[model samples]
Target chain A: MSAVDTRVPQPTTPTPPSPRRMGPDARRVTARTVRYTLLFLFLVFVLIPVYVLLVTSFKPGTEATLTGAWDLPQNWTLDAWREAWDALSPSLWRSFAIAIPASIVSAILGSMNGFVFSRWRFPGSDIVFTLFLFGMFIPYQAVMIPLRQLTSDLGLASGVPTLIVVHIAYGIPICSLIFRGYYSTTIPNELVEAGRVDGAGLIRTYALIVLPLSAPGFVVTLIWQFTSVWNDFLFAIFLSNTRNGPVTIALNALAGGQLTDYAASMAGALIASFPTLIVYIVLGRWFIGGLMAGSLKT
Target chain B: MRSRIRNWGPGLLMVAPSIVVIAVFVYVLIGATVNESLTDRHTAAPAENYVGLENYANLLDDDRFIHSLKNLAVLTVVFVTGTLVLGVLWAFLLEKGVKGEGFFRSAYLFPMAVSFVASGVVWRWLLNSAEGEGAGGLNALFGMAGLDVLQNPWWSHPDWGMAAMAVPAIWQLSGYVMALFLAGFRGIPNELREAARVDGASEAQLYRHVLFPQLSPVALTALIIIGHMSMKMFDLIMAVSGAQYLTEVPAVYMWQALLTNDYAKAAAIAIVLLVVVAVLVVPYLIHNARTERQR
Candidate 1:
C-alpha cells in the first residue's frame, strides 16, 4: 500500500501548473468553492420544478400566464387547485381504492415468499427465484394483450379486484426480489436455525422472527409498488372502464388530448404528485437504505 | 413423525400462496399468449383457429412494427452507452471523496424517485418548439443568449427529436448507474490503487489497467439491467411523444396493436419481444450458470 503518501490536489478547474503542488489555503478555497457551487446548482435543479408546480397550482390560469410558469403569483388563488381536485376526485378515489390494497397484498405475499426462499435450501429454490427474476425482465407490454383477453374471458374486465390481481401478479417480481435478497443477507441463518432448535414451528418462526425482521425492506417495496400502481396510465386505461380507471388514466383523459390545457393540467399533475413525493421525502432514508442494502453489502 | 409433519407443513403452506400466484399469473398467462398468437382473436371473444405463421408474417411486414424495432434498437444503444459511460465517470469522481458528497449523491439520485409523468412534462417544456417566442425553457435561455438553433421546430429527424427525448432519461438514470458502480468501486480494496500509484502509474493508467478489470462483473450486471430497461421503455416515449407511431418504440406499438383489435398481431409482437429478450438473457443465464459451477 505504499502509494504516494502525497495528498495530491486534483485539478478542480483550469489552473496554471505550479510544481504540481499548492498551499493548504489554496486547496481549501478551491475545494470549498467547487463543493458549494455544485450543491447550489443541484439544489436549484431539483427545487425549481417543485417551486414551479406549487406556485402555478395555486394561481388561476390567467395569473399563471401573466406571471410566467417560473414566476411568483401576485394572487394566491386556490381556484386551479379546486378545479384540479374536482376533476381528479374520481381517479383519486379509484387509485386509493385499488392501489392501496394492491400494495399491501403484494407486500405481504412477497414478504412471505422471501421467508420461504430464505429459510429453505430446497433443491428447486434457486430455480424458483430465478423464475421470479425472469418475470422482472419480462416487460408487462409483452403480455398486456393476452392478459386482457384472459381477464375478459374470466369475465372480470372492469373491476377493481381484477386490477388488484394484476398488480399483485406483476408486483411480485421486484418486491420478492428485494425481500429475498434482504432476508438472505440481513436475517442471519443462525437465527432461523436457533428458532428451529428451540422447537419453534415454521409459522411461529416466521411470524416471530422473519416477518418482523424484514419489515423495513417490505415497507420500501410497498411504498415503491404503491407509487407505481397509482401512477400507471397504460394498463389502468386499457384494463378498466372509465368508472374504475385510476387517477393517472383519469388525469390523462382530463388533458383531453390537447396541449392548450397544460397549465391547469400541470396543476392537476402537481396534486397527483403530492402523496408519492411526500412519501419519498419523509422516507428518503429508509427507501434508499433498502435499495442500497443489497447492492452495498457486496 | 407427526411432529415432523407439523414443522414441515407450515413452511410449505406459507410458500404455497406465492407459488400459486406466480403460476397463475406468469406461467398461465404465458401459455395463453402463446395460444393466442396462433389464433385470430378479438376483444369481444377469442377466435381460436390455428392460423399458423400468418400473424408472425403480418406482424413483421407491418411498417409500424419494423419502425418500432429500429427505434428501440437505437434508443437502447444510445441510452445504455450514455448511461454506463457517465455512470462510471461519476462513480470515479465520487471516488475522489470530495466534500458535500451526501448532498450531491441525493441530488443526483432524486430524479430516479420522481414519476415519469413529471419528468415527461419537464422535457416537453424544455424541448417544445411550438411557442413562437421561444417559450420553451431551453429555447428561452437560448433566446437570451441570441442563439437561434433552439428556434428550429424540427421534430421528425431521429437525431434531434429522439436525442432531445433522451436527455432526461439519461440524467435520471446516470446517478442510478453511478450508485451501482460505486458499490463495485468500494469493493475494490484501497491497496490495489495505492500499489498502482506507487508504481508511478497515472490515474488514467490505474483505471484502464486496474479498475476496469476489477469492475468487469459489476459492469456486466449494470449493462444487463440497462439493456432490459431500455428494451421495454414506453412511458417516457409516450409522455414526451404521443401519436407519432413511426417514432414510437415496440412497447407502444404493441399497445396500438391492442387498440386496433388485432389480438393475434399483438400476441405475435409480444412473442417477438420475448424472443428478443431471450436472445439477450438466455446466453446471460447460461454464462452465469457456467461461472457458478466453475466456482
Candidate 2:
C-alpha cells in the first residue's frame, strides 16, 4: 500500500460531513495502529529464532528435548553454558589469536596501499586498484586447492599462523578498498600537498599526514576484518583441523556431533557469536558505513 | 623527468607487498587451479597427467553436479527475492518515520553480526520437519497457534528443500539489504518528494515514477552482491543441511570432492564456480569503475 496513507492527518478545510464515513482522525488512528501492528509482527518473526536459542540454551539437558524446543525451561541451569564453554573455549582463544593479528596486519597493509592508490598516482594505479578489487569477489574455492598446497609445501600445513596469513592475504582487497575510499574522500589532496611542501617524501607524507588522519579508516577496516575472520568457516574448515581450528569448526562439531546436545549446541551458538555481536552493538554505525562503502563503489 | 621515477618508486614499494600477496594467492593460484582441473590428480596417488577437459565433461554428465546446480538456481532465486522484498518493505516502513527508529533498525540488523554457522544451527532446529506431537521450533509455534496447515518438512522436502534453506538466509541478510535501501531512500532530496506531492502525485505514483528509477543503481549493487554470495554459498548450507543431497550446492560438492581426494574434480568444480561468479560480477565491476572515472 501507499506510504502516504500511513501519514498523520493534516488539518483540512471544513466540508459537509457524511453520516456513513468515519472521521479523518479515526482513519489516521487506524493507519497508525496497522503500521505498528505490522512492525511488531515482523519483529516477532525476526526474534523467534533468537528466543528459541536463548530459551533452549538455558534448559537443562532433560528439558531441552527437540519436541519441547519452544517451551521455556522448567529449570534453568548453567550446565549447557559450562559444557559449551568447555568445548569451545580453546578454539575461541585460537580464534582470538588468529583474528587479532590478522585484523591489525591487514589494516596496516591496507592503509599503506590505500594511501598510495588514493594519493600517489603512479602509472596504471587505477588498473592495479581495479585488479585488486576483483580479488575480493573471487570464490575462495578457486584458490583453496593451490593455497592449501602452497601452504603445506611451505611448512605451514595447519595452525593459527597459517590461517592468519591466509586471512590477511585475502583481507587485502576489501581492507584496501575501504581505506582507499576513506582516504580519497576524508583526507584532502591539499593535506597531502601540504605535507609535500614541507619536503616530506611519499612515505613521509603518508606517515606525517595521511596516517594521522586514518584512525577512523583503521577502525572501520579493523572491525570489518575482525568480524569476518572470526566468523570464517570455509577457510578454517579447509585449512585447519579440530584441535587447532577456530571456534566455528569446534561449534560445528559440537552441534553436528553424532549425539546432539540441544542445550549445549544452543549455548555454543550464542558463545561463538558473542564477540561479533558485541562489536556490532558497540560499533554498528561504522560497520554499516564500511559495508556500504565496500559494496556501493559509485 | 628523473624526479618522476622517484615519485613512482616509493608508491610502488608501498603497494608491492599487497601486489605480491594477491599475485601469489589470487592470480597464480587461479592459474594453478585451472591447470589442476585439466589433470587426473587424485590424492590417493599423484598421477597428475593431463586429461584435457575430461573432468569438466564428467561434471556435465554427473547427476549430483546437475542437481546441485538446480538447487543453487532455486536457492538463489528464492533467497534474492526474499531478502529484496522484506528488505524494501522494512526500509520503507522505517523511512516513514517510525518512533524508536534506532531500536527497530538495530533489532532488524543484529542477525548480520552472527555467523552463518551459529544461525544455521538454530535454524536447523527451527525448521525441524517433525509433525504432530513431535513438532518443535516454528512448527511447534504453528501447531500451538492452530496454524498446522502452514507447517511442512522445511529444508528436508525433497523438491523444495533448497527453497526452504533460503529462509535462514533471508532472516540473516534482509536487514543489510534494508540498510542499503534505506540509505538510497534517504539519499533522495526531500524537495523532490514535496514537489511530487504538490503536483498531485499519489505516494505510489511518486515512488514508481520518481523514487524507484533513482534506486536502480542501489538495486543493482544489492543484486550483484547478493547474487555472487548465493552462488558461492557454502557455510550456511553446510551448517544447516550438513551436506545432504537435498540441498547440496556446487560449493558444498566441491568441498566433498576435495575431502574424497578427488582433486581434479574438485578443481574443476571450483573453476566452474569461479566462472559463474565472474560472469555475473566482472561486468558490474567494470561498469562501476567506468562510471566512477567519468564522475
Clashing pairs in 2: none
| iRMSD of all candidate structures | 4.2, 2.9
Q: Residue B62: error of model 1 in Å?
A: 2.0
The candidate maximizing DockQ is: 2
Off by over 4 Å in 2: A1-27, A197-199
Please provide, for model 2 over B189-249, each residue's C-alpha lDDT reduced to its tens digit, 9 standing for 90 to 100: 8888888999999768998999999888888998999898999999999998798788899
Error of 2 at A205 (Å): 1.3
The window of 10 residues in a row where model 1 chain B has the poorest summed lDDT is: B152-161
Q: Write the per-residue lDDT of candidate 1 for residues B1-295, one digit (tens) a residue.
A: 8866665566667767777777777777877787888887856476867888888998778877887888888788878888898778667656556655666767776766766665665455555554446365555655656886656543346554555556667766777787888778777888898889899997679989998899988888778777887887777777666647646877777777777787877778888888787778667756764574475
Which candidate leads the pack in lDDT? 2
Residue-by-residue lDDT tens digits, candidate 2, A74-118: 998999999999999999999999999999999999999988888
lDDT of 1 by residue, A1-298 (tens): 2233223455455453463586654655565566567556656655555666677677677766521666677787778778878888887788888888899988888787777776754446667766776776786766676677677777775758778878888888677767776787788989988998898877787888887787677778887788778777667766886577877766665544564455666677777777776776778766565455333222
- Candidate 2: true interface contacts recovered: 0.73
